[model samples]
Target chain A: MNALTTEKLTKAYSTKVALHDCTLAIPQGSVVALVGPNGAGKTTLLEIATGLVKATSGGATVLDGLEPGSLAALQRVAFVAQDAPLYQAISVGSLVHLAEALNPIFDRDFAIARLKEVEVPWKRRVGKLSGGQQAQVALTLAMARRPELLVLDEPTSGLDPLARQEFLAHLMNQVATSGMSVIFSSHSLAELERVADYLVLIVSGEIQIASPLEEIVAHHRVVVCAPGDLDGRHEIEVIDRQLDVRFGSHLVRTRNMETLRGLDSHATTLEEIVLGYLRRAQGIRVLEEIGRS
Target chain B: MDIDKDSLPTQQDHPSPISFGLDLRSGVPTYLQLVQQVEAALRLGHLQVGDRLPKVKDVVSSIAINPNTVLKAYRELEIRGITSGRPGVGTFIVVAPPTISTKAFDQLRSELVTGWLRDARGVGLEDDAIVALFHSALSESMYLANSEGSRSESDGDA
Candidate 1:
C-alpha cells in the first residue's frame, strides 16, 4: 500500500493558486524528497497531506486509504511542520510531559532517552535551546509516537552544515532500525541526494517529475556538443541548454542512448537535474504569459 | 606491572571489523564507492575472509547516508560471491581476493615508475594529465574485459 496519495489535490487562495490538480503517490518504505522553488506548492502540498490545511479541491489519503486528518490517519502519520513549532515557553521536560498527556501513543521513555542521547537539556526552556536542539526535540517527539510515516517540511532550513548532517544521520538511523517511511521537503539538493531514494519535482504549483531517483539519473544526460550537432535530433527532450560560441551543453531526457552517439554525454547529478527542470519550467511560464498577452 | 584483562578492549566491544567512508564529491555513485572500498580493502589484505561488515544502522549513523545505499553495496558484494549475509547474524566476507606477493608488487611498482611514468613525462604530460590518462585507460580496459567475458560466456551457453 502507498504511504500517501493525492488525487487532483488543488488549493487556491483569493489571489493565487498554491497547488493545481497535483496527483502523486509515494510508495511505502520510500524516503521521498519534495523539491521546488519557493511558492511552488511544496508547503501547500505537505500541509494538505498532513491534514493541517484544507484543500480547495480534491483530497489526500495516507497510510492505506485513510483520509488525511481523520483520527486513524492522525494516529499513523506524524508531521513536523516548517520551523518545528513547539511550545517555546515550556521547559523541554514539560514539553515531553505535555506530549505524553496529549497523545496516548507517545512514548515518554523513548523521548527522554533520545533527548538525553542527543544531549538536549531537558531542564532548559525550549526557547532557550539552539535551533538544532529544538529541531532534534521536535523530531524526537515525532519519532516517539512511533508513527508509520513521518512528514517534515524544510527540516534543515536553518541548520548549520554539521547540525544538518547530525540531524539527518539520526533520522536515517531510525529508518534503518524501524523501517518507518519518510517524506520531507527541502532545498538542500546535495543532502537530499544522500538520503532520498525517491524524487518529486514541483514547479509553479504543478507536478513536473515524480520518479525513483535512479530512474531520473538514468534517463537524464548532460550532453556537451557543438550547437549544430543537435539540429536533426528530435528524440531527445532538452530540458535545459547552455550555449557558448564553440559548444552547446544540453540537459536532456532520452531513453535511447544511441541518439546521443558521437557526443560527450555524462550522467547528471540531482542538483543539475532539478535546476534544469526549474529553469525549463520558468521558461515555459514566461512563454505562456507572452502568448496570453 | 599488572595489567587487568577486564579493562582491555574486547572483540565484542568492536563487533565490526570494517567501517565505511563516503566521498560525496567523488562523482561516483555512493554504493559503488562502498563496494570499491571493500574491494580495495580485500586486495590490500586489510579485510580477511571472515571479517564482519558493519550493521546498516551503525553505518547510517556514522555516514548520514541512506541505509539503502549500504544495503545495495552489500547486495552487490553478495552477488559477486565476496560476502554472505546470515539472517540474524551479520554480513561476513566469504571470499578473499587474490593478493599480489610483495616481490611481485615491488616489481610492478618499479616497472610502472621506470617505464610508464618515464614515458608519460618524456611525452611532456603534466601530472594531472598523466593521472587522467591512467584512469581512463584503466576504466577502458576493465570495460572491455567485462564485455568480452560476457560475450564469450553467452556464446558458450548457446
Candidate 2:
C-alpha cells in the first residue's frame, strides 16, 4: 500500500515557491531520504506532509486514505523535527510519561526498554544529558508513539561521524523491528547513499528525481577522456567535463552506461552522481518548466 | 542521528576488524561487494549454511551500507540459492545450492580477462606488463582521490 502520497503538492514561501506541484507515491515500510541542496524545499515538503505547513495548492494523503493533518493522520505519522522540542526541565522518565500522557497509543514499557538499550539515564533531565543523549531521548519519545511514519529533518547535521552512525542504526533498527516507514531529509549525499532505500532529489523547490537508490547508482558514471577523445561525443550526456593536464577527464552523470567505458575512462561516485542531478535540475531545467508539470 | 560522539566508536575505528573492503563509497556499489564478500566468506568457511547473517538493520547501522543494497544482495543470493531469507527471522547462508552452482561470476571475469589479454596481446602488452598497468591505474586513482582530499583539507575548510 502507498503509506503516503502527494498529489500535485505545492508550497510557497513568500513569492518563492518552496515546492512546485510535486507528485509521488511512497510505499509502506520503506525508507525515503528527501534529498536536495539547501533550500530545495525538502523541509517545506516534510512540513507540508506532516501538516505543520499547509500546501498552497494540491493535496496530500496518508495511509490507505486520510487527510494529511487530521488527528488520525497525526497519530499515524509521528514527527521528529530537526529542532526536536524537548522539555529541558523534564527528566527522561517524565518526558516519556508526557508522551504516555499525550498519546493513547503510547507503549511505555517499550519506550523505557529502548532507553535502557541506549544507556540513557532515567532520572536525569533533558538539560543534563549531552546533545547526543538528548537527541536519543527525543528519538525514544518519538518512537514510543509507534507511529506508522517517522520523519526526521536534517537529523545529523552537526553530529560527528560515529554519533551519526549510531543514531541511524537505532533508527533503522526500530524501522526493521516495527515495520515503520521513514522519510527524512538531508543534504549529505554520501550518508543518504548508505542509508536510504528510496529518494526524492529536490533542487530549488522542485522534485528533480525520485526513484529507488539502486536505479540511481546503476546509472551515472564519471568518465575521464582526453580532450581530443571526446570527439564532440553525442553518445552519452556529460554533466561536468573539465580538461586537466593530468586526469584529462570530466565528471559526468548519465543514464547511458555503455558509452562510459568507450569514452576512455572510469565511472564517478555516488556523491558526484547526486551532485550532477542537482546541477542539471538547477542549470538546465527551468523552474517554470517544472512548475507547469 | 543526534547522538553524543564519545558514546560511539570512530568509524572503522577498530584497530581493524576482520573486514573485507565493503566500502561505503564508490558507485561500483555496495551490494555487489556484499555478494562478493559473502561468497568469499563461504568459500573460506567464515560463514556456513544455516548461520544467520546480521539483521538487515544491523548491517545498515554498523557498516552504514545502504539497506537497499543489502536487500538487493540478499534477494539475489536467495534467488541464486546461495542464501535464504525468511521474513522477520533474518537471512541465512544456504550450505549447498539447492541446484547446480552457475559459477557465473567466475566465467564472466575469465571472459573479460581473456578479452583484456587479447587486447594487450594485440597492443603488445605482456602479462606482467598488463598486471603492472592495472595496479598502476588503480593506485593512480586512489592517489588522486587522497591527494584531492588533502588539498581540499588544506585550502580552506581547515
Candidate 1 chain A: 10-residue stretch with minimal lDDT: A255-264
Estimate the TM-score for candidate 2.
0.76
lDDT of 1 by residue, A1-293 (tens): 89889899899999999999998888988899999999999998888888889999987899879988989989988999999999999999999999899897998888999999999998999999999999999999999999899999999998989889999999999999888899999999999999999999999899989998977887788877876777788678888887455787889897555576666667768889999999998888899999999
What DockQ results do all the predictions give, each relative to the true complex? 0.43, 0.23
Q: What is the interface RMSD of each candidate, in Å?
A: 3.2, 7.9
Write the residue-wise lDDT of candidate 2 on B1-158 in tens digits. 33655554432343222243456644456777877777777777777776666656667656765556667888878887888877645577776444335797778788867887778889998889989888757856764564466456546745
lDDT of the candidates, in the order given? 0.88, 0.74
Clashing residue pairs in candidate 2 (N, C-alpha, C atoms within 3 angstroms): A132-B3, A132-B4, A222-A268
- What's the TM-score of every candidate structure? 0.85, 0.76
Docking class of 2: acceptable
Residue A284 error, candidate 2, Å = 6.5
lDDT of 2 by residue, A232-264 (tens): 555556665553564555665444343443444
Predicted model with the maximum lDDT:
1
lDDT of 1: 0.88
User: Candidate 2 DockQ score?
Assistant: 0.23
